[model samples]
Target: MILNGITVGIILILIGLYGMIAKKHVFKIIFGLIIISTGLVLFFVSVGYVDTGAAPIVSGDTTYVDPLPHTLMLTTIVVEVCTTTLALVLALKIYEKYKTLDISTLEDL
Candidate 1:
């Protein structure tokens, strides 16, 4: 199950990368970045997952899943939300100024 999650994450990352590279719209690129972030979070969580593991609390004779990744992902998700909001705000400003969301048109202007 963990491996499956990892694989799905990798695939999502790749798809996001392709969108960022091949898409012509700024919104699409922003969406791609969001997708990449999601994939990374998924991969990170999966990496720290342990089969039949208990919570990372102090306990005797209990296997604990690593908490570092979960902690990092929490921070990452906060940053991602901020970043996405900023990107969307910037995109809105760009649209207001240029009246278009197309990268090619923006370049021509």
Candidate 2:
């Protein structure tokens, strides 16, 4: 399960990298960043996973998953949302001023 999660996360990261690097539209680049953030969150969560692990509150001989990664990911998600929103707002403002979202066209203008 952990391996599967890691694989998916890596795939998402790759897709996001491609989107960011290959796409010319501002919104697409913003979406790529969002995807990368999501992939990072998934990767961290998978890294913290422990087989047969229980929450720290449980009193047993079972392994306990570290809560730090999960906590950090939660904070990351909040930050990602804020960053994405800001990026989108900036994109919108750019579009309103330039009337285009294409990076090349914007550059030429």
Candidate 3:
């Protein structure tokens, strides 16, 4: 089960990377980044899981998933959101300046 999750997460991350390279559109790139982020979250979350456990907390009785990776994943997610937002903003700004979102025509700048 854990291996399966890892495999799926790697596939998702690879697909996202392919999408990033395959698309020339900036918005698509941002979406690709989001996908990548999701894949990373999945990967990290899976890494933190134990066979049988309860989430780590101040007061807890059962074994738990590794909280460190989960916490890191959470922070990574926030950073990913910010990255996508900034990507969108930059794309929009580029479009406004060039009147087109195509990267091919950006050479004149």
**Best prediction by TM-score:** 1
Writing each residue's lDDT as its tens digit, candidate 3 over 12-84 gives: 8998999898877777777788888888888888888788777788565778778998889889989998888
Q: TM-score for every candidate vs. truth?
A: 0.89, 0.88, 0.86
lDDT score for residue 108 of model 1: 94
* Residue range 1-109, candidate 2, lDDT tens digits: 3558788899999999999999999999998999999899898988887888887566857789878889999899999999999999999999999999999999899
Indicate the TM-score of model 2.
0.88
TM-score of 3: 0.86
Clash numbers, per candidate: 0, 0, 0
Candidate 3: worst-modelled 10 consecutive residues by lDDT:
100-109
Off by over 4 Å in 3: 1-3, 58-60, 107-109
List ranges where model 2 is wrong by over 4 Å: 1-3, 59-61
RMSD of each: 1.8, 1.9, 2.1
> What's the true lDDT of residue 72 in model 3?
95
Candidate 1 C-alpha lDDT tens digits along 10-107: 98999999999999999999999999999999989878889899888977998888899999999999998999999999999999998999999898
Model 1 ranges with Cα > 4 A deviation: 1-3, 58-60
Against the reference, the lDDT scores of all candidates come to 0.92, 0.90, 0.82
lDDT of 1: 0.92
Candidate 2 has an lDDT of: 0.90
